[model samples]
Target: MRGLFEGGRICEEFSAGYYGVCAVGGLISAGTTHLAITPFDVLKVHMQVNPVKYNSISTCFTTLLREQGPSAFWRGRGGKFFGYGIQGACRFGLYEYFKKVYSNLLVDQNRSTIFFLSSASAEVIANVALSPFEAVKVRVQAQPWFAKGLIDGFPKLYASEGLFGFYRGLVPLWGRNLPFSMIMFSTFEHSVNFLYRNVIQRRKEDCSKAQQLGVTCLAGYAAGSVGSIISNPADNIVASLYNRKASSLTLAVKKIGLMNLFTRSLSIRIMLVGPVVTLQWLFYDTIKVLSGLPTSGDDRTDVEQIRTT
Candidate 1:
């Protein structure tokens, strides 16, 4: 176990093992945090699919509680857990891998560009892993009678709609997650750099573990909130499509209206995403630290210098 965690063993020199560890960290962070917010997710989906019936967050909460009882809040949690776990693993792991690859490839090595490209590339694949589960999760959440959770939901969806059923919303999922990830990773990386350079007034390596983690939390929240706002329209469309609220994306947008797409349920989503993203970065960095790796986005020049030496 110690060997697994040690720098020179499993995580040696940022090889495949190191990326694997990062992937594990991503899974733990995303899976647990998303699972913990099942109730709020249910509310968000209802508000998106049937805003008239569900209405505001408070109204939706009360309606679901009254109509379906406590279990209603946890609908689709299994899909949420496994779906996000796989997505997170691929997202974080591939981001690291691509970041390194892009860094080495680009002669100019522009950090922001690297951040955006790496995250976008990574999310493309990650969302593929997440889409099937996301389809099940949305159907289960928006219409509880569809199935119990991922267990029954998966088979029922398959039987009813076949393999295509699992991927029906893949386009909307991409529409939502792609920009979300690009904004998230780039914002997080820039925010971390800014905080350390401006507010913290020190190098990241000089900070204690607690302080580094605090920076991670702050940066992650900022990124998540921004990403949530940018992605909300696509998110609503995903829910609308999966819930059969609309036949297609264009039709869904028309039914949802332009303004409602951006505004409705936006606040609740920001609230949910902010802390979830914060905790994810905190957890991911914590695991990296535990594995004797530096916190992410910490002094790229320094790392490069070390590699050269």
Candidate 2:
């Protein structure tokens, strides 16, 4: 069993050429999903910060359309694409690399442990990698009144904040992303396997592309929703933090924690972000499943870590 994972066969067998292919696919998959669901993201944030002004996602979207026009949804489209594109790319790429690295660092295991640790380690690495991009994306996305589409948000951020600006929300970004990534990937992989092996075993092997796709979508959605709830507040903090010009991470944390920090308005945040995340996960995992991206595999144990320059 140990030798099996260590063999080159697993990599070759993944059907994506090598692990790197999955990373590339994951990047593309995540990017398209982010683009599609960004409008909800915009609305979610608004709801979190200013709930009274907006009642619901639909109502908020409609109001934004009425006042600012439909184009409002794309307020920070540029930052999202490039920022999140790079993020997704790095995330998937690094996750594969890190999973292998961490797995090998220790020793062998069954598929379950492998799936959990590899994914969790990979997620941490990926989240760390994404800090700067996330900072940029949040900054871009937060500014409600950017004249052009989301792309313009990048130039605006650069013009206003300089290099450091791109990294503004990194601390909070990590706070949100690290846990989110760990939970999301681990759960998604496990969920898919659980369903296929037990709940839906009979059809998986003979599954048509469409059938596999359907299962993947469900797994992805479940994992994504779980991830979103775990990750939202950190996300909000990252978004809020990036827009500021704080001197340091400590300063930023202090700033964000000005009121109660950990105890800060939970009920409101949930009411706003909960629905958005639910939909966001549904849409996001759907993209991954459809695109044939890297997912947690059957071997639920340790994954060998590999690195790329």
Candidate 3:
């Protein structure tokens, strides 16, 4: 019995070490993915905040291309790496970590509502930790002349904004990310779980890994769509509020309106922000499952197997 317990301990420890390594590697991959698509992120934020100015993603892209040159797409890779990389690490790592914590703490995870809350809670932690980084990323992305890439962007943003600058969009960011992450993590978790338990498991063990990944993404996309709609107003506000002068988050929220924030926001022009967020989530979650990373967990260690695959 003692030997079995010792073996289990060894296994768990081994799993944890592997999980960390996989998470870092996955983070790098995820970071690269973010860098690759940053132009779209910028475009989307612009559409949300300055829609009248830019109109749509296509128009925004064309304007940047025509005005700044085609290479303008790579304008903010510097801050993108720093800000987005940290966000990816915190989000993926914490989410996996929290899911397990939630599951262990609340054994009734079988309950759908519990799963929703669990994911939401985990995402909130992630959003808070990543907010400062996001502020940096947003400013860098929005400002065309700051620097060419991540290496220069960090110091520049820090130099100009100081710590406060790095956190420029934090309040609205929290408002947006809180619900986005919550709904995203929870919905993604439930979606993956449902797929794994029902569609994949019931279908057959003979199902290919690709089949599983497809199902996981379908689940992820579904949840992402809902989160995008629910939080569109806040998301748009974050992008807009950061560019303007503001004393505090509350002030910004006040500007946007504490109640019925979506309808009140002048900055967010995307009346259809939900579909956009949905698209973004679909892409994001598809990447997660395809990479064999954890969909949601309270502890990062349990995801070693998922990550390694």
Candidate 4:
């Protein structure tokens, strides 16, 4: 892996062109990972919305395969393939871009503040780009009978619900992602810093290629678990709203009820998210390395500790 990016230069300075590369790398890496995990996501949705039918992961897999065929596992992947591609690209690219911007503004260079603001800003932009496809994705997953895929779903949604339908769940989506990104990114940054300083006793820049990947996996899992648990409630609302269980936000919450909303599929999310996030960061960082760009979330204390001293 290191040999592939051996010619890659460490960016001592940020540039617009480099940011563009980061965006492209982010897009490809994120899109690939999300698409690859679509089957798991499909299973997760079933577990969330129709726990009785799905019950367990193994049961869901066999049920979908038996009833809907192999394609059933990827039922609504179109939206995720495209929507999350853009979301991943923006989330990563803008995160790096914003971190630079924020760091320049603050003398103390607080990692938590920078991570929160940058991740939050990126997520807002990413979710906007993601909403339409995400709406389509959720709808297709919840109502597998809705349409076969994006092509069918997009047209069908527009015809039945008009333009507003594509964005119906935007509020809940935002409600879910914002805090998720905040905790996820901030925790990831802190985790990386902690792991490198305390665990590895070395800065990120000094770590071997394999070491970097290991840290990313550990940090991603930790961040994903916390982020998913915190955001699952809003996530439930998004699923419910898009699935037609409720017409409005108030009704959606009312329909879901407090206990079910919070606890529904909480374990599934943590289990699913831990690996998904771990792999996402792994792919995202590896792509950056192969693309000759700076590693994601490596701009904090440990790296700075090496740079300043």
TM-score of each: 0.93, 0.70, 0.70, 0.90
TM-score of 4: 0.90
**Predictions in order: lDDT:** 0.87, 0.57, 0.56, 0.81
Candidate 3 residue lDDT tens string, 72-169: 66655655565556665656555555555666788754544555664456556655666665665666566766655556766876787787766666
> How well does candidate 1 match the true structure in TM-score terms?
0.93
Ten contiguous residues with the weakest lDDT in model 2: 300-309
- Across 1-309, the per-residue lDDT of candidate 4 in tens digits comes to 233356665443378766776787678767877788888888877777776787788898898899888888777777877888899889888988888888889758666888888899899999999998988898788787788788888999999999999889999999999999899999898888888877887776677778888988899999999999899999988887888878998998887689978887787778777787888898887766766654566535576675665
Better of 1 and 3 by TM-score: 1
Specify the poorest-scoring 10-residue window by lDDT in model 4.
Answer: 1-10
Query: For this target, which candidate reaches the highest lDDT against the unseen true structure?
Result: 1
Off by over 4 Å in 1: 1-10, 301-309
Using TM-score as the measure, what is the rank order of every candidate, best first? Answer: 1, 4, 3, 2
RMSD of every candidate to native, in Å, equals: 3.4, 7.6, 7.5, 2.7
On TM-score, the candidate that comes out on top is 1
lDDT of 2 by residue, 152-236 (tens): 6556667877877666666676778777777777776777667766665543435554555566667766776677667765764
- Which pairs clash in model 1? none
